[model samples]
Target: MHFVTGGAFNGKSAWVKAYYHMEAEAVGNWFSGYRGDALPEDLHSAAGVIVVLEGIEQWVKELLMEHDPKSAQDMWHAALEKWLQWERGQQGRVVCLIGSDITKGIVPASEEERELRDTAGRVFQDTAAVCERVDLIWYGIGQQLK
Candidate 1:
C-alpha cells in the first residue's frame, strides 16, 4: 500500500497517476470519494494491477459525521485491512490511497469541524502505519515520507 497526502490542489493525485502511469481511459481502477465512489468492499476481482483511492478526507468527514468516533475509525481501519489483504493476495497488486492534508497548525472554530479534523488526523496516522510507503506532495513536488 502507498499513502500520499498533501494540501488540496497540491498535486498528490497527479503525482500518483504519473508515478503509476495510470493510463486507463475508463473508470477502470481509479476511484474517488469526491466522485461519490465508496471504498471498495474487496479488491480481489479488481481488473487492474493497481487501484487509486483519492479524496480520503471526504470519506473521513462522512464517516465522522455519521458514526461515533471509535466506530467510524474501526470501519475505516477494517476497510484498509481488507484492501491491504487483497493487495498482498496478488504479487503485483497495489493500493494507493490519496488524502488531502487537513491536519494543520490552525484549529477549526466549530466543534464539528474540529472533530472531523481530529478524526482525520488519526485516520491519516493509521493509514501511514499500514502503508508500505508514504509521500508528501507540495506544489508539484513529491517527497517520500516513509
Candidate 2:
C-alpha cells in the first residue's frame, strides 16, 4: 500500500493516476486506471487498491456525526474496523490519497477548519503508518518518506 499526500492543487491525483497507468503498462495491462466516480467491481482483481479522498476532514467529521454526539476519533475507530474487515476480504493493495498543507496558515482560522486540519493530519498519520511507503508531492515533484 502507498499513501500519497500534498496540499491544495499539488497534483496528488495526477501523480496517482500516472503511477497506476505506468504500473499497468509495465505489467501489460494498459487499460487499467483510476475510475474516481465509478467504483468498479474489478477493483479487487487488481494487485492493489488506490483510494483517492479529496476531503478527509469533511468525511471524518460527517462520520463522527453519523449518529450524532460521537467524536471523530470514535467514528474513525469504527471506520477503521470496517476497513480492516474489507481489507481482509481482498488480497490486493490499498492506497489512500489525501490533501494536506502542513502549515500554520493552512491550519485553518475557524473552529471547523481547525477540526478538519487536525482530523486530516490524524488520518494521514494513521494511514501512512500502515502503508508500505508515503510520498509528498510539491511543484510536480515527489519526495518519498518511510
Candidate 3:
C-alpha cells in the first residue's frame, strides 16, 4: 500500500496520475479510484485493483456528524482494518490512500472539529507505518516520508 498526503491543491492527484500513467477510472479490474464524502460500504469489492481513495478528510468530517466520538473512532478503525486486510490478501495490488494534511493549520474551536483533526492525524500515522511508501506533497512537489 502507498500513502499520498498533502495540503489542499498540492497536486497529489496529478502526481499520482502521471506516476501511474493512467487516469482515475476502472480499467480491466486492475485499477479503481474513488473520491466521496463517505467511505464506501463495500471496500473489499476493490480487491486485486490499484485503489485510490481521495478526499479522506471529507469522509472523516461526515463521520463526525453522524456518530459520537468513540463511535466515530471505531468506524474509522473498522474501515482501516478492512482496507489493510484487503491489501494483504491481494498480491501485486496497490492501495493508494490520499488525505489532506489538515493538522498543519490552526486548531479547531469546536470539540467535534478538533476530534476530526485528531482522528485524521492518528489515522495517517497508523496507515503510514504499514504502507510501503509514504509521500507528502508540498506545492506540487512530493517528498517521500517513508
Please give the clash total of every predicted structure, in order: 0, 2, 0
Query: Judged by TM-score, which candidate is best?
Result: 1
- Estimate the TM-score for candidate 3: 0.82
Candidate order (TM-score): 1, 3, 2
Q: What is the TM-score of each candidate against the true structure?
A: 0.94, 0.64, 0.82
lDDT tens string, model 3, 51-128? Answer: 777777777777777886567767867776777787777676677888888898788998877898988787778778
Whole-model Cα lDDT of every candidate shown, in order? 0.87, 0.54, 0.74
Candidate 2: lDDT over CA atoms? 0.54
Tens-place lDDT digits, model 1, residues 32-128: 9989888776876578688888888899888987798788789899999899888988788889999998989789999988888988989999999
Consecutive 10-residue window with the lowest summed lDDT within model 3: 28-37
**Between the candidate structures 1 and 2, which one is better when assessed by lDDT?**
1
Model 3 pairs whose backbones collide:
none
Please estimate how well model 1 matches the true structure, expressed as its whole-model Cα lDDT: 0.87
